[model samples]
Target: MLQETRLIMGMPITICIAEGGAGARSMAEAFGYFDAVDRRFSTYKADSEISAMNAGRLCRDAISAEMREVLALAEKTRVDSDGYFDIRRPDGSLDPSGIVKGWAVRNAADLLREAGHRDFFVDAGGDIQADGVNEDGEEWRTGIRNPFAEDEIIGAVRLSNRGIATSGNYARGRHIYNPRQPGDELDDIVSMTIIGADVLEADRFATAACAMGADGIYFIEETAGLEGLMVNAAGISTQTSGFGAFEIQ
Candidate 1:
């Protein structure tokens, strides 16, 4: 038997598992870990880890091993994407929204693993980490929303033991607010989705790559371990190496 539970991690989060008996309770316990971490580390919150770092109250030396890992990832992503995925705005405030959600989701998934749950899915907002097979003993199916057409799905992918993340201008609007442009207006790409082993890295890469516009698509293609599918403003779709694994529905 399969059971699903919804846990509040500041935002609503769903955990699905196939543990037969007590699956729901185990899923809830797994989500409890997420809630605790969300309260302590969520960058979206005003007093969270990144906020403390931005305020200079949380020294880099004081950062936990987990926080340090995510921060290091953010720094590496900034460099790899040529500053497209900056955690701080010009005002020096932290805006790690692009990466934090996926990071949290991945961590929550890890919690499930630690709890002895073998098959599960953790979704934080649009970011996801799916392990094992679904109800039909098949890979989980996830849809990629069409940025140009609201409520329409451009494609879907079936995955097992992998992560999938999408980035677009539709949610927050604008192309991730170009740091280089400052106050200048920015254009939005149709959508960009990436699949990889780590949802955290894939999420940040997708956002940064989309923010880079057409030029970043080439960079994404050259980057190793990451596969991307991008829809341009004109609705043309392009794929990076290994992106063909995604089935366009």
Candidate 2:
């Protein structure tokens, strides 16, 4: 088993490969991809593509293919979440951070798989895309962090060839807001976690649903092929009917 963790893109990204043949070369290449992503997408960086666009230095038509793809995905999320998942900030600047992390994780997993590493786990911050089994040849056990107490875990889920994402205010603190009502206080729910076919799918919906406050889990319950768990401000957790199926007992 090989595992490495690095602080990239403003978070601790951990990649673990269960297969014995996995090497430093593939791991380096994967981390390099994340570095490139940060350079191109980070709004905090002065020379990043996102910053350049925000500063009006780059034309929309001149943006890279990846930028265009992220923009399209953001727009789709906006529509799918009834405008609650917008990427535009109050200053009219675009911040696609919410979706980019998961997208990056998914791509990194693909890179590892392409390199013939089937049993691996890619976790960017708390968002995860796990494939195959762990070193013990068991499903990856993902612990959902408690929003009220960061060091504590509220629940655990078993996953293989699946993705999970958590959106919340505890770690980041009011980073995500309802675009429809920017001033609305999202005090009802502190965290929202979504499990989907892949990390990108789970992440985009998690961001939107968290912005929905307490109604987020209901939305997950209504959405097909998605399950969610929500922790409210009172430290009470609520989950969709199917979410129990993913629990690790």
Candidate 3:
């Protein structure tokens, strides 16, 4: 079965799943699961888990099992990124949007696998996770949009059972602010793409790496099981060790 549907998550959530005979039905079920997770974890919602934590009604000790895992990952990312991937805003509010979307998408992919779909793809607003190749037997091809060029692709990558996430200043029009340097704007880097086994890690790494500018490349390269490529404001490109395998076409 192969099915596609939209789940509500402060917006339309389009979910797609491919399986033998129950693709549609299974995807619908997965959407239900996704909706539940969204309601519980969404930062946009006033009553979501993260909102609760921000309100002081819940702490990390009182978080749900699923959120506990996400929090742990967030903590690890904050450490690995040298505090660049923080969840707290300058005003002391939790802003997990950088990592939660990818986390949810990856979890949806896991649900699809549990439903017997060996191959699937989940794209939650550009954060992507693929379990296997597409129907053509080739790896998934992801485009790296050119920030300065309209309708142009600067590069692309072929991914297999991997997660790819991009953080760019272009998407939100300078909305990706740096909490550490509240008075300073993030310049020099236009976008950063990170690929890794975990979508959450990839997402946070990309965001933090973009904030770090040129200095972040070395950290991403040395981090085990992670690789990244960055496109700076001047359009200069730099990539880590394993990043060469993903072609820039």
Which candidate leads the pack in TM-score?
A: 2
Backbone N/Cα/C clashes per model: 0, 0, 5
| lDDT leaderboard ranking | 2, 3, 1
- lDDT tens readout by residue for model 3, 161-201: 88888787654335444455533433467778889886767
Return the TM-score for each candidate structure. 0.81, 0.92, 0.83
Give the alpha-carbon lDDT of every model.
0.73, 0.90, 0.75
Candidate with better TM-score, 1 vs 3: 3
Model 3 residue 20 CA deviation (Å) reads: 6.2
Question: Which pairs of residues clash in candidate 2, taking residues 3 or more apart in a chain or in different chains?
Answer: none
Give the TM-score (vs. native) of candidate 2.
0.92
Query: Deviation in angstroms for 52 in model 2?
Result: 0.8
lDDT (10s digit) by residue, model 1, range 130-230: 88888778778878878666689877888778887878755434544355654333344557788878778678888888787766567778888878888
- When summed lDDT is taken over every stretch of 10 residues in candidate 2, the lowest stretch is 170-179
Superposed model 1: Cα runs more than 4 Å off: 1-12, 43-46, 171-187
Please report the TM-score between candidate 1 and the true structure: 0.81
Model 2 local distance difference test score: 0.90
Checking candidate 3 for backbone clashes, the offending pairs are 1-19, 1-20, 1-21, 1-22, 1-23
